[model samples]
Target: MKMRLEVLLVVTAVMCAAGKPLSKAAARNKLLLISFDGFRWDYDQDVDTPNLDQLAVDGVKAKYITPPMLTMTSPSHFTTITGRWVEDHEVVHNMMFNTSTNLKLPHKLTLTKSQWWDNGVLPLWITAQNQGLKTASFYFPGGAANYSGQVVNRVMVEPFNHPNANETEWRQNIDMVMRWFSEEDFHLVTLYYGEPDNVGHTKGPDHPDRKTIIQQIDRTIGYLRKAIDQHNLADSLNVIISSDHGMTTIKKRPLVDEIILNKYLNLLKLASFEILDYGGFGILTPQPGKEQEVFDALSNAPNLTVYKKNEIPESFHLAKSERLPPIVVVGDLGFNLNSRFIVYVNKGDHGFHNGEMDMKTIFRAFGPDFRRNFLSEPFDSIHIYPLMCKLLQIEPAPHNGSLTVTEEMLQLHSGGSQRAPVSVALPLLMLLTFSAL
Candidate 1:
């Protein structure tokens, strides 16, 4: 009887040591991702962004994170969430091709739940959901409509310009996020602010109005921080702020002339060619036997580099799906390509390959789970997803590169540990036990 009791005690101790129960308070902690679109890292104008600056000073600041090739809203947001580049997800731009179906119109593109899963990609919200945590987003680019086909716990879908127009929309969105934060069921929320990007695009980054817009955005950040404090959720919530891409002013002549393109169309015997503004120049699809001819025509074009699908840079990690045009064209600095003949030339635009280091955007994090007074070395935007996953105590979706500099920031907050052992290991063991049963 004594020997049996000793064996039982040893087994119980081994089990307790190997798999401990996680503190509910720690496991239920939250993550908030905020995207301040079109925000540049070097815009050190003395604005009213005390709260955002506080975040920078208190957490990690990722300097010089490069945007994707198109640098468009959809692809940038997707890359930030998915840890995959434009090509891998088949979403290269705000306007994308649904090659799964032979549809050309937006309405014909049915976004079913399986579509998101079939892509082999999962956004941070989805990952949180899989961990049995509630998730929400307000007006994220692709998040406007339910891509997953299932309604997220909280989703705010309204036109960019609605009744609560201007900065008020941003403030209200943050308010909604605060409400969600107070909920015991919720664990993750995402808020997107489009004013800086919108105003920056309409009136170049140097425009006088840009200053006012940044100040308003800064105030909104202050409001959000205040709300977090008022709700007593500061310590339990991790706030991550990032931007989709940076903006730039365009003063140079259009690099690819529409007329020159149309004139050369016959030489390549192509069916259709479209010139995207801000150097997203590409051939949609060429007629049979014209692939090589079109490739040759644009390969050596001045101020541009052309590549066939297979020849694109490996670093880009874009997919080889049919959504990608057979030929990809990228413009050099001080150049843009336009298909729509607008009467007036826009003074400001992003999405062009300007090769300017200043064009890199900003990434900052604040909360109990982040490091302070540190700057992440220049890294790609795709690195953000892995770091976010790690901070949330979840497994990251399989990705090519490791985590971003923000991981170092998170480690500092987590006591220089790779992860919070209690938060990570406990949930993993529970999940495994449930699966086994």
Candidate 2:
């Protein structure tokens, strides 16, 4: 009798803890994931962001999110979507380069290169579509690639030298996304905005023009919310606004310290291929038999931390990929590693170590599914993938995200604070049996 009673109590607790099964209506909820590139965690601290503040009042806002290492545009964005570290996804740099041929393609051209993005792991768009849900991506990195013969149902890649600051085009893009939700009935849509990041790169993060871009982003958010209501689909839509990484003012030459790699090491003789003149990160493929020779030369260089592929700190989670060369270089915050000369031409840059405060970015969510007026503490951006899968009511691919890290932000009826019933039940049943014996 005692054993039976204990088992009964355990079953009751398990069922109660799992909560009610998600309702069909709840499962039908749609999701919109938006990325505003380079939107810092504190971008709105100085500027008045009425719409964004209103969003915080309506739903949820995280204090900040730490992106994966090498906080450049493509790698960080891919990490958010795939919940994988930079090395896992293997989209290690904005520019696509071949280590053997010494061929390189700029960021824009790299977008159309399927071979560059179609690695073994699947991004969320392909994962969602595989689970019988329709998905689309607009100007989002990794969106246009054919992931092992599967492709997103809808995609809009940015054209060459596309103007990033056109307000009208931004609005039009929003309008089109609304159509994807309402007319085409997409279950998930990811939209990208190239903003203050563009302005920050050219004029610096602290420049007055960056404030203007923030205002534009604020206005666009207002437009997005009003459009959601106008479409009469507000109750069925869940929206999350976030960014890839933050920006920092680059320490230019003749003023502060810089990492001119060629000045410290002989690239021509020591390296077979080198990726430099980018931002605060670089990669080197040493000439055969010269691995230790190259590492010794760069290890003591100022304003840079050099690591052999195997010696890269475990905190970075960057040593697992074949795409990575033998030696890796990370410039200190506010510095860019240069190859031949200091020719970055930009006043601000990213791609610093992920732990830097300047590399943290923004996260906001609103809709019927989220908690009202909730402010969450900082969390890693990799957890976003599981949160999105929960919102779409689909099984997620194998990912690094944990739903527990983000599930608290969801409303009770929207699958918050619930574990799979069987997962919770098994342990309790075993405990009861052992105690009875």
Candidate 3:
């Protein structure tokens, strides 16, 4: 009788545990985050972006989302997904330190499967994989096959170039994403379009051709939206449009004379200083005891803000990392960092901080689950990751910012009643000991 009673009790407990309700929200919707690189907010007025405008009317639009430091591709993209500054994530730029000594590091450091690890942070794809949700990326900068292994279900490598040469390649990227949406089950997807950014880099943000490219991208979004609706997937689909950074037009290209730089180099008794080619500038490490003299000379130069690595602005969040060079140089807006070997003929550059507004990018979210005809207080792009987790009904990882999903947006709210508290199960030994004594 005793053994039979025990068996019955075990069965009852198992049923109770199995029947327990989860504390998470129901993840019934799919998420798509699309990055239109170098897209400026003003472009909306310049071009007829009906789909994006519709998203704004049917969802929430945040007027500004400031890009994280260097305001470049690699770091800004990482910031959007990681919800942390590049200094914390350790992917400060497209090219980073390879460490003087070769030794295995954290999984995050392994930038590529083949190379030794370079970064030290996990991106959102890894987080989604941990939760057993399917994630996909279409030609995102950081989602290259070399870096995204088992973390992402599909990754397409499509480089940015003129549409004339890369139109077929670009179309292939769109076709692959559409096919995946039609065939596979994905919880999260990220798509990247690089034409506007490429054109802005070569021509300028205000270039007439940029408007044409914006229209092309808008048409692509229209096609995707139409496909979803035609397949009756609108209720379960969500779309987010954002950008890496904004672009500024340049009118003057500065020249750095080799003779002047060499004079300083000889006086400093440096073995050799590597001058970066093109308008992009870099200074190789100087011999010991000459670092200060080299920095002082650059500091006195016109149209430059020279800062020691530690003195980089707190707003930029670049002070904490060792990946930064000992001395950092920033050029004024509309100016490029030039070296003796090369000159910049055109006027357009990013990656340098002019001010907060100049570095701001666009953020828009639209879907059945989002709040419609609303706008939230401008927040950092880092908030997007946590917000995504919330929308997907996953336990949010600790983040530096709060995600505000207002009740009006969702059209639901608790009527001043406290939700029931939930208790997690204790280990068997602890439960047994605490049961009676």
Candidate 4:
């Protein structure tokens, strides 16, 4: 009789828990984070991005999302998902060279090589997977690397197996995302599109071609939205769209001389010293005793800022890594240190300080969980990690972000654009704990 009573209590508890209105945390069970590489916040302001604009009208949009310092691809992308700065995450720049060991990988190998990233910090994909939630990433930085011996359940290292893959490839990529939800039951999905940024780099940001690419990406988003509705997954899914960083027009090459650089620092070759270059930014290691000369020559140059390893701005969180050069030089709005052998480049670039408004990227979200037609106050992109955790009902790892800043972007308990208590997630952690028992 006692055993029967015990069973009844357990069943009653189970039914009550199941019947309870899902806390907002668990209300939205699916997440899709899509990154449009080099998507400037203002691109939609001028361009006819109907789908993105529609998302803003139906969901929430941020006025600006300040990226981490040295606004480059790998670092900012990692930051958005990890909620860690370039310093803590240890992907200091898109193109990194470790001064101590003289080790660096070419930019072409970034997506394929796990060693180039694989910092110990956990990205959201890994975090979700560790919790027994299935996660997938399509061409996102750090997706190739396993964090703490755990990896995303699925990863497409390069979307089309090549860098210069075109829209037809991206359209297929979108179809694959739909499949993830309908067939695979992916709880977390990350999709990446290298556009407007790619075109903006080829043709400056003001070019009509740049606008064309932006419009194309918008159509892609519309396709994604339509796919979700077609799959009947709208009530359970949230789509968070953002960019790694924005683009800026580059007009001049300030440090295009190998001879002059070599004169100041010995053996400044691409193999050891020249880490990498983007217009208005250079990451290079100075040979021992030549650090002074390298700093002096580049610091005084017109429209450039030079900093030693310890002197980087505190807000950037890049001061502690040995992966950074002993000397970092940043060119003003449109300048870069390029290889003298290179020519006819610098249409657009993005490796600039975060202070530059153009360096900021776009952030928009739409789903069952987000407030409608809301324009959120500007916030740092780092805050995105916590918001993602809330929407997906996962516990966020230790991160440098505050949910309070973005909680207003979520729908009220009754589904209005109003504030509610932060969603406290009591995920099926008991299942995780009891499986061991």
Identify the leading candidate in terms of lDDT.
2
- Among residues 3 or more apart in sequence or in different chains, the pairs in candidate 1 whose N, CA or C atoms overlap within 3 Å are 87-318, 87-319, 88-319, 371-409
Ranking by lDDT: 2, 4, 1, 3
Per-model TM values vs. the true structure: 0.80, 0.90, 0.77, 0.84
Q: Per-prediction RMSD in angstroms? A: 7.2, 5.9, 8.4, 7.4
Winner of 2 and 3 under TM-score: 2
- Model 2 lDDT vs. the true structure? 0.88
lDDT of 3 by residue, 175-243 (tens): 666566656877878888776777887888788888888887777767777767765667877777899
Q: Please report, as a residue range, the 10-residue window in candidate 1 with the lowest summed lDDT.
A: 105-114
lDDT (0 to 1) per candidate = 0.64, 0.88, 0.63, 0.76
lDDT of 4 by residue, 1-437 (tens): 66555655554555465565445325447999999989998998788878888988999899989998768888888888898888888887676465676666655477756666776788999888777789998888778786666777898887434654377777788888888887989999998877877787888899998888888888888888888888888898888999988888876536443212333334443224665345656777666667777777666555567788798878768889756777777767766555333443758888877778888888999988887989988899999999898887778988998888897887744343353222321234334334433
Comparing 1 and 4 on lDDT, the stronger one: 4
Expressed as tens digits, the lDDT of each residue in 1-437 for candidate 1 is 66555655554544575464322225446889988888876654456667667767887777668877667676688788777767676666554444334334231132222343235566677767777778887866555445445445666654533432267767777777887888554787778777577677677788878888777777877888898888888888888888877777755545434323433345335645433444334434556678888777665556666678788777655546546767776655435554334333555666655246545788778887666777778787878888777767777666644664455666433346544455555566555555544
Q: Measured by TM-score, how close is model 4 to the native structure? A: 0.84
Query: What are the per-residue Cα lDDT tens digits for candidate 2 across 235-266?
Result: 99999999999999999758976677887778
| Candidate maximizing TM-score | 2
Supply candidate 1's per-residue lDDT for 155. Answer: 69
